[model samples]
Structure formats: structure tokens, C-alpha cells
Target chain A: MEAALTAGIGTPLSRSAADALNSVDLTALTPGTPAFVGAVERVLTSFFTTRREIVDPLGPVFVDAAEALAQFVVRGGKRTRPGFAWTGWLGAGGDPAGPDAAAVLTACSALELVQACALVHDDIIDSSRTRRGFPTVHIDFEDRHRAAHWPGDGAAYGSAVAILIGDLALAWADDLVHEAGLDPAALARFAPVWARMRTEVLGGQLLDINGEAGGDESVEAALRINRYKTAAYTIERPLHLGAALAGADDDLVAALRVYGTDVGIAFQLRDDLLGVFGDPAVTGKPSGDDLREGKRTVLIAEGLRRADPESAALIRTGLGTDLSDADVDRLRTVLKDLGAVDDVEGRIRDLTHSGLNAIAVSTTTGPAKKLLYDMALAATRRTA
Target chain B: MEAALTAGIGTPLSRSAADALNSVDLTALTPGTPAFVGAVERVLTSFFTTRREIVDPLGPVFVDAAEALAQFVVRGGKRTRPGFAWTGWLGAGGDPAGPDAAAVLTACSALELVQACALVHDDIIDSSRTRRGFPTVHIDFEDRHRAAHWPGDGAAYGSAVAILIGDLALAWADDLVHEAGLDPAALARFAPVWARMRTEVLGGQLLDINGEAGGDESVEAALRINRYKTAAYTIERPLHLGAALAGADDDLVAALRVYGTDVGIAFQLRDDLLGVFGDPAVTGKPSGDDLREGKRTVLIAEGLRRADPESAALIRTGLGTDLSDADVDRLRTVLKDLGAVDDVEGRIRDLTHSGLNAIAVSTTTGPAKKLLYDMALAATRRTA
Candidate 1:
């Protein structure tokens, strides 16, 4: 089963991954745009630099934590979240060269900081040791503590420092957005979305934790978590906020939200698949890590319901345990045999198709629409 | 030395404590200024109620923490901080019943939340089990975990839950202030001060943790921490912000700051003395709890500096241990023998006198000045 499926799908997935990357014309951005990008970059850099300066006076402990946070943020990712915000502003017939663009970017930059805080704290909670192919903040600090012969358990010290750093990052994110100097009315409009995003993310975290504690792992429960935890915050809220800041009308904002919600869920579903099947070299994580972590994904729940009794027992026993290569292979085969993987993939295609349909009807077009389309496809179609 | 102090003082401290409480017209506040007082109370109640509603969806773990926080906040304290802010606003000729008043109280309410988060986190960091005669949040959660037979160490679970709760509170504090509906110009002016206040408090915490860890025990270092940690945040910034929002002239803001700084430091010094020597029944805690917890206070540093070599070594060794009642007695004797308690009392008197003098020379006198004067004396002279 493994040889047949791998041979059938491997080449097409690779081509799709390459095609998605190729669609984003990184070089097509005008030279004039970098000035705006540079301004946003400068503000973000200054925001974090000032943060480091402020925390530096606190002590070496605070300094170390703040430095780690700054480093983690500055180390490049796709910057897709901020880019979505910037492009959304431009798509609403707003000038990217104006102060509004800088303001939007500044707010967008704060999203990254917020993301860093969430990721750090999430890693601590999940007991994850690595992120983006590097040791997590807690692990990094723990290693330092061990090297320095600290008086306490190195892991505990690392966790404590990571918590404090996350707190500081959250505070700084708010401060940066406040100081972005946007129109008062616009900022007022954006405030609730920002506030709700934080609340939903935290609420989603609570839901995730509760599910892992062996309470109701129903489809409705997982979908609720996905909506609040990932979909709304990661995509819908950011687009709405960007649009709101540009004085976008309700219809446009509503359209973007529909588009965002579909893309967000599709993105997460794709991530679940990759977590189980993608190569470690490409994903920067071990294959089958989500299964080992016993993540309460829709895929797993579907698989559990559809599998034969003997197979279901095997999965229940093996779900959270560290699995050998052969064990992972067997679990993957069972999941495929139960048709859970195909079912999830089909759902992803439905969401993507719906998202594209929404985009076609959207009043917004040109570069912003193009970028959003590319992003939506890239988010859902990735192998990693 | 204890016998000598009892013989010399003749219970003057007890009388001063009673006189301080009697002097404040807290009851007269309701009848004379019902609208103003009502506004402040309404704002605080709504803030906490809204917070509880928002956190309710985060599930039982978060709901438990939120309820505990709401309960702690609703059991109101002196309301001196909000009173100072209102007095400052009114003293600067701002209407007490206007939007500015609500803004001031909103900001003041946030200060209380900030204080709650700090106290909760501080208890976790210090491993203390009680606050304000109630089981601390961490301890309360730990007890709940143990009772429910939850997985993991009860203490770790308690700390984890408390950390998240504190994060939520801090995030809510920023949201409340940002959404306080102040004028744009006023918000722009207030932003830097608000940012600085948070940074300073964190900075002060760092100084304190370091000083305790390093065993510095220096009077200057402890006072520096008090200035940033308590003095600036507690009094100076709140008053100045209220004044700034009201568009007070720089001269008036400067004058209020001078008065606030002195009173703020005096307030903390009084708290330190109460923690070490105040009557347990009156203060609602065990006597000499700070001594048992080995808080690195100015009084302790002064005692060590002035004590004989043998006594100094004993004091240094005793600094961070849970001392017995008899040991606390001996520690008090050592402090009194070195005249450290008397020195602190003298410093408190000087600060109170200076604060009153600042208020007297300023042209800002009115009901606000009278309120500040009463607050200064009460803060410096209180036993609890």
C-alpha cells in the first residue's frame, strides 16, 4: 500500500509545492515598495530594539529572555501574515506609499510579535522541544541554565524565563500598535477586532488543552476550536482589521472574512496532513509528530470512527506513544485504509474551491486579490 | 531592645495608626460627591463584570481563575489610587462628572488590575501561599487540582493556570485603557506615560528579584526599586496622567508629581514596616511575615549595615528563610538595636512632611489638595 500510494502521489505533490512558490513573484515588488517595506521594517526593528533597551535595565535574566524573543522574531519566516495585511490595505484602494500603509504595516508587525508570544507559550504547554528546526525558547534557555550550572531545574528555569518573555512580547505588541499614529476613528474600529482576536486565540488554546485532557473529542468541538483558535485569528480578523484601517466598507470586509475563514481552515487541515506524512527535511519537524503528540485533529477523529475495531484499538494504544519508523508506516496505512486522509483532502479542495469562488465575487481585485489568491492556494496546497 | 522600644514608645504607633484611619473622610465621600464616587464604582464593577463574561467561555480552568480574580478585585481596598487620580483631575479644574472623570477612573481601574496580576505572579515567583488573608490564586488552584486528583504536580498546575490568568488580566488592562474613549490628542499624550509606567514596573521587579538573589541588601538599591516599582506607578504617573488628560499646564503636572513621588515612597515604606512589625490581628496576617519571608527591605539593609559583625552575619544568614516566631523576635531585636526601625520611621516622617510642603506651596490647592494631603498622611502613618 505504501509503495503504490507513494509512487502515485509523490511527484504531483512536489510539482504543486514548486508551482505555489513560483506564483509569489518576490522580485515583482517595485523598488518604490521597499521604501514602505523598509519603513515598516524600521518601525518594527525600533519597536523591538527599544523593548530590548527597556528590559535590559531590568537585569541579565530579562535581557536574555528579551534577546531570545527579538532574535526569534527577526529570524525570517514567510511574513505572510503581515503581507496579507499590507496587501489588503492596498486592495481597498488605499495608497501603499502613504502613512496609512506604514501604519498598517506597523500593526501587522505587531501580529508577528503576538504570534511569537503565542508560539513560545504554546511550545512550553505542548512540551515541544523544537520549532522551525531550532530548539524552542524554553529548551534554549534550559540549555543555557545547564551550561551555567544554575541552582534550579534547568527546564523549570527555561519555562519561567519563556513565560516572562512571552508576557513582555504581548505588552510590546500593544504598545507598538498604539504608537502607530493611525487616525483615531480607524484605530477605534480596529481595536475590537484586535481584542477579540486575542480572546479567541486564548479561548482556542483552552479548548485544545481541554480536549487533550481526554474530554469530548467530537467533530463539533474540534471545528469550534479551529474557528476561534486558527481561522478567525490567523486570517479573518487580520484581513478585517486591515480593511477597517483603510476605511473599507462593510461589504468588502464581509467578503474578505468569508474568504479568510475558508482559507484558514484549509490551511490547518493541510498542516495536519503534513505533520503526519511530510518529510522531516522539508517540514523541519519529525514525521508523524502530531500523532505522537496525540493532537485531537479532525483527521484523527474521522479515522478513529471509520477504522475496524482491531485497527482502532491499535491506533488508540499507539496514538500518543513515540513510534518507530515501522509503527508510523503501519499507522499511516491504517489511516489511508480507513479513507480519513482522502476525506480530509477532499474537504480541503472544497474549502479552496469555495474560497476562490468568494474571491471572484469580491469587489476587490488587482494586486491585493492576486496576492490573496496566491496565499490561499499556497496555504492549502503546501507539502510542508 | 524590644523591651527598651516598648518602654520608650508608649504605644504612640498604635494611636497614630488609629488617627490616620479616622482622618480620612472615606464615608463622607459618598454623600458629598455621589456622582463622582458612583462613576468610579460603576466603572470598576463593569470592568470586572465584563472581564468575567469574556473569560467564561475559556472553560472551567480559566473560569475558575477568572472567578478568583474577580472575587479578589471586588473585595475593594482603600481606593486611594483612583481617589488620587480623580483628585488630580478635579484639582486641575477638570469636571469630576465629565468624560474625563470616567477616563481617569478607567485608567485607575486598570491600575488595580495591573496590581492584581503583579500580586498573583509575584506570589507564584516567591512561592507564597496567601495574600490579603486569602489563599493566593496559585495556592487556591493547587488545592483545587489536588482535590480533583488532576494529573501533574498540583503546584505546577496551579502555577501554569495562574500564569495564563495573569496574562489575560494584563492584556485586558491594556485593552480597557486603549478603549477608554479619550480624545485623540489626550490619548497621544498619555501613550508614552502609559508605556513608561509598565516598563518601569517591570524594571523595578527585575531590580528587586536581582537584589534578593545577589544578596546586595543595600538601602540605596531597595529605595531605587521602590521609586520605580511603587512610587512612580502608584502615585506620580496616575496623577500626572489624570492631569495630562485634563490638559493641565506643565507646572501643575510637575507639582503633582513632586507630591506624588514623596507620598508613593512613603506608602511603600509604611507597607514594609507593617509587614515586619504591625499587629497580626489588625493587619490580617501573621506578624513579622516579611521577616519570615526574608524580604530585602531598606530597614533590613540598614540593620545589617549598622549591626555589629556577629549580629550582621546572623541577619544576613536569616534573610530569605522561614524564621520561627522566636527567631522573628530576635531579628526585631537586632533591627531595633541597630536603630533601623527608628531610622525608617524618621524617613517616613520626612517624606510625609515633604509631600505636604509641596502641596502647600503649589497654587493647585482645593478639594483635590485637601484630598492629597489627607492621603499623604494616611499612607505614611497607616499600620496596615
Candidate 2:
């Protein structure tokens, strides 16, 4: 069934290579490890194929939309959530070759679907035009509407269709988890984790939007948003879910959560830094995109608090404005001079250290411990 | 837990009277029977209370949002989906006093949450201001944003928040089903039904928007959209889901689906008529709102097809445009004169007849058959 569903989707990348990594050496399970990433990609391909079949009778237009969603899922960013989940499962003494391994992989791959829903909806909410060097779903739809000379407001049509598409992605995410063939016992344990992760992420989004609308720029507010919005779903819950799936004890689960929270915050802090300073070529967005959007990140909050009065005024005025290259450079210099850049880097180091240390002291399997440590460094120190 | 959750939420209507409905006699199980409606209400209340606690720590604003959501779920239009599901269960010989009754109630009540998600998102997509005599979620949020003197565009914030709220409701709907404690075998049977209903409704919505944007006017297009958009989720799938939960055989499930489809379509036909000619005070909108919005419903499609050239030209010109009250009256006259109203009424009668006939022949429980017959009538013939 899996093979049939994935037929004509390009061949799975290096399954043999991935399978080879499973032989004798379990320590090679770091984040974005190709072995697990390949397995996840195959699971996603099969899932989308099933979805495409479900929507086929709706008509060519709907079929096209489903295909677009499928393509969007199959292509793009590092599968960080799944990678962490793999490590967590391994850390909990779950054997990759065990009978439950397939079910575990299927279950964890669901995080990617959730991520797809988030990015698709978030793009619509933020009115982002591009992502990963391609037009965002709404923008793509808007372009289609205009090119076809369709009646009505193109932008409204775009947003409306994108809303449905995002909704479809979300519904499909739940479906994938339910259909993953997890045993009833495992499913029962994983249910609340799934539920809480969903609510937490959405609640975090609500808080972030509310803060933006209310002009809330407190460092505390920013940190709180980061913990829920990016941290919990992205790392903490995925790890916890993996551990629970393996029937790991509470001690290990709690320790993993501690590690997850620290690492997740560090991940978001890295994101904040990248949002302002990363090259457009690497980030697929203009430099200082967050600043241009007046996003209230922890880095920005700290800069506001620490800068001199004159520099603070400059930072405030430059935010949410259309800045030239030179102007962005000027703002960058000010932030660096204010020591905000160094402060954030220092925080990331401290958080990563604490997170790794937690894992170090835990009863995590030796192989997964090394992988988790490697994942921490990669997550915080990546260029994009 | 249920009582505590429902405390301070106002008393459920006539629980004892409803309980009496289960005494030896079963024919009292008609759609919207107070007994089942009250139970569904209690389930929803408890579900929302749990959600409120989950979001409480987020702050008072979020708490208010959750409260508003809970209130909206409790106070609204007839609980039609739950009513149908209950009838389906009864028809399949489900025992109202059985151990599974509460679980079934909890499971079926999820339809209400799905409906909540649909209405909230639809209001945003259509930019509707009110529903069922109350301000729509987006409009309510927009008002709050304005009153609070928030910095961003109030409309954008309203739509964004509504999107997240809809997402939450959708997620909670799934959680309710998972938490309902349905046996694994029952869950397995019900999973596909639940999954399909979600896809069909969202797919229907995509079709509706596509029709509007692409100027699709064929009666075929109109009927197809109506079937998937309103009929499937609203009636057919709810019955199928309930029957599945009750472990009904496929033959009975098939019979129920046929009845559901016919009744569901008839229900939408009535709705289309109401859209054009219902009393504004009763429908909670100005007269001819659908005509003004130029919704491409079956009634409108038939009108365009059957009218004389002059009347056709008139409809083409008037639809989707701002018009005076006098102009609306003129359009109403043209539609009536074109026999469009009679055409739709004829369709409703025929559909409702076939729907009731399906139940008449089925091996459905005597009481449930009677109830189903009554529900078919109420669904097709009601004004609001």
C-alpha cells in the first residue's frame, strides 16, 4: 500500500543509505540525519498520495490545489521535529529495527504536516509573498486568479482559498496520526501530547498577534511567546511525544522536556538573529524582515532596553519602516554596538549548555545522548 | 467533572423531561428532541470548560475568548447535526441507557465543534457581520480591537484571531472524539467517516469559492456544490458516523446516507429560498442578502436559466451590487414571476418525499423511523 501510494512520486532518497545507518552504529541519529529524514520523506509522500486520491473527484481545480499542497510538503526545510523525535525515541531505548519502528516513524512524520499547516496559515496571516524561494500559497493563488482574469477581488480569493488549503493541511495532519496504525496503548498515551501541542502553538500565535496589535515589547512577553509559539511544538512536545510512544518513564520524559524547552528557546533566539542578520540568499527573505515587519523579538526587546537614548530612538524609528540597504546596515551597526547581538549569542550558548547538560545527566541511551548533543549545536548555530 | 464544568454556565433545559423520553417507548427520539439536545449541550459545556482552563494561564484576554467561544457553542441555532447523529444511533438499535451512551454523546457532540469551526472561518471568508442574530466572531473581535485602541488594522486582527479560533475549534473537535473513550474497534470504524466529513466540507467550501470567483452558473455546478458543502457534512456523514459508532451494518448505513443526502439537499433549498425572501427580522439580516451578495445558489441558477431575456438581463445586472429596497422588491417580483420560487419548492418537496420514503422502507427501529420522518419534514419545511 505504501509503495503504491508513493508511485510516481520521485523515488525515496537513499533508502539503502538510510538503512545502512541502522546497522550496528546507532549513534549516527543526530538532527537532520539523512536516514530518518529519508524515512520521513517517504511517509509524507505516501500520505499526500492518499490525500490526492481523496480530493480527486472534487475536480481538476481542487486536484491541482491538493497537488500543490503535496508538493509544498515534500519540498523544503530540514525536518527538525522528526529528527528530534527520532533521537528521543532512541534515547528511550526504542530500537529502530523493532516491530513498532514503522508506526513510530509514521506517527512522528505527522509533525511535518502540522508544520505545513502552520507555515501555510502563517504566510496568509503575515501576508508573506514568498517562502523558501517560492511564492507563498496565497500569493500563488492570487497570481492564478489574476492571470485567469477571474471575477471578484483576487486577493480575497487568494486568501480564502489559502484558508481552505491550510484547513485541509490541518485536518490531514490529524488524519495521518490516526491512520498511522499505532497500537491502542501507544495512541492513548500520545493523544494528550498531540492535543496540548496543538492548543499551545495556536495559543502562542494568538499571544504573538495580540502583542503585536497592542504594541507589547517587553522582554518577558517576547520570551513567553517564544516558549509557546516556537519552542513547545517545535521541540519540547515532539520529544515528549516520541518518549511517550516508546513508553519511556516519567523521569526521562521530564528531563527531555527540560532539555527541549531550553533547546527550543535557543532555536527561536537563533531565528531572531537570522531574521535580522542572515543573508537573503540563505534565508529566502530580505535582511531585517522581522524589523521591517516590526516583530517584537527578544533581541529587539533587549536592544530597546539596553541602547542609549539616542540609539533607542533610532531603533524605534527604523522599525516597521521601508529601509534601504544602507539604513538596514546602520540599524545593524547600532544593535551590535549596543551589545544586543553579543547578549543574544551569550544567551543562546547558556541555554544550549543547560539543555545539553540536562540530557547529559539523564538516563538517555548512550547513542542518543551524542545525537542530542549534536542536534543542539546544529539547531542553535545554523546559518539559516 | 461534568457538573463542575457546567456550573455557572446556566442550567441545561429540562433534563428530567428529556430523560423521561427514554422510558420504554422509543418514538420520542425525533430530531432536535430536547433530551438529546440537552445532552449535547452538556457535553459541549464540559468540553469548553476544559478548554478554558487550558487557556486560563495565557491571561484574561484569552480566557475571555474561550468564554465567548463556550457561550457561542451553548447559545445558538438548533443542534441539527447532533440530532441527526442521535437518530442514526437509535435507528441502528443503539440503547440510550447503555454503557456507551455517554461516549456516543461525547463523540457525536464533536459535530457541533466542527460546525463552529466552519461558521467562524466562513464568516471571515465572506466578511459577514452577523449570524443567528448575533455578531459574527470576526466582527466581535473587530469591535474589541477598535474599542481597545489597538495599533494594527482592526479588520486584519479580527480575521487573524478568528482564523486561530476556528483552528482551535477544529482541533478540539478531534480531541473530543479521541477523549470520548470510544472502544478501539468503534474508533477504527468511525475514523474514516470522521476524516471524510472533514475533507468533504472543506472541499465543498473550496468549490463554493471557486464557483463564485470563476463565475460558474450551471445548475449542475450549483447542485454539486450544495451536495458536498451543505448536504454531506450536515446530514449524510453525521448519520454515517453515528451508525458506525453503533456498529450498524453497511446496508443500514447506506440507507441512512441516502435519506441524509435527500433531506440535506432539501434543507439547503429551503435555505436558498429564505436567503431571498425570508423575513429580515427572523433571519437576522436585511432582506435579499444572498441576492445582494450574488451567491450562486441553486435557486439563483434556476432563475437565470428559466427567466426571459429581459428578466435574465435584469438578474445579471442586479446581482452582487448595492441596491435600494425598491430594487430588491423588483428582483423578488422577477424571480417569482419567472417561476423560480415554484421550481425550488417543487425540488424540495420531491427530495423530502424520497428522503422520507427511504426511511419508510429501511429496517430502522420503529421509533427512530418515526423520528427520522418527522426530522425530514422539519429540516425541509422550517422557516429559519
User: TM-scores of all models?
Assistant: 0.85, 0.90
Which lDDT tens digits does candidate 1 get at residues B1-384? 113212321110111111112223332342125544555555556665555444555456556656677776656565555666656776677774454544555665566666666777677767778777788887987787788765546776677667766666677777667656567787766666666667667667656765655525678778878877888778877777667667777667777777777788889889998998999989987889888777888888888779889999999788668888898899888898889999999988988887778778776748778878877877888777
lDDT of 2 by residue, B1-384 (tens): 113222312211112212222332233334576765766777787777666545765666667677767777788767889888878888898897677766776788889989998999999899989887789988898899999987769999888888888888888898888877688888877887788789889988988998889747888788878888998889988888888888887667777888888889999999999999999888777899898898899988899999889989999899999988999999999989888899999999998887788778887889889888888887888877
Question: Which digits, one per residue and each the tens of the lDDT, describe model 1 over residues A294-328?
Answer: 78887888888787899989888898888998999
> Deviation in angstroms for A365 in model 2?
1.6
Regions of candidate 1 where Cα sits further than 4 Å from its true position: A1-40, A50-68, A127-158, A307-310, B1-41, B48-69, B132-135, B139-157
Best-matching candidate per DockQ: 2
DockQ of all models, two decimals each? 0.12, 0.32
* lDDT of candidate model 1 versus the reference: 0.69
Chain B structural similarity (TM-score) per candidate = 0.84, 0.88
Residue A263 shift from truth in candidate 1, angstroms = 1.0
Candidate 1 root-mean-square deviation in Å: 14.3
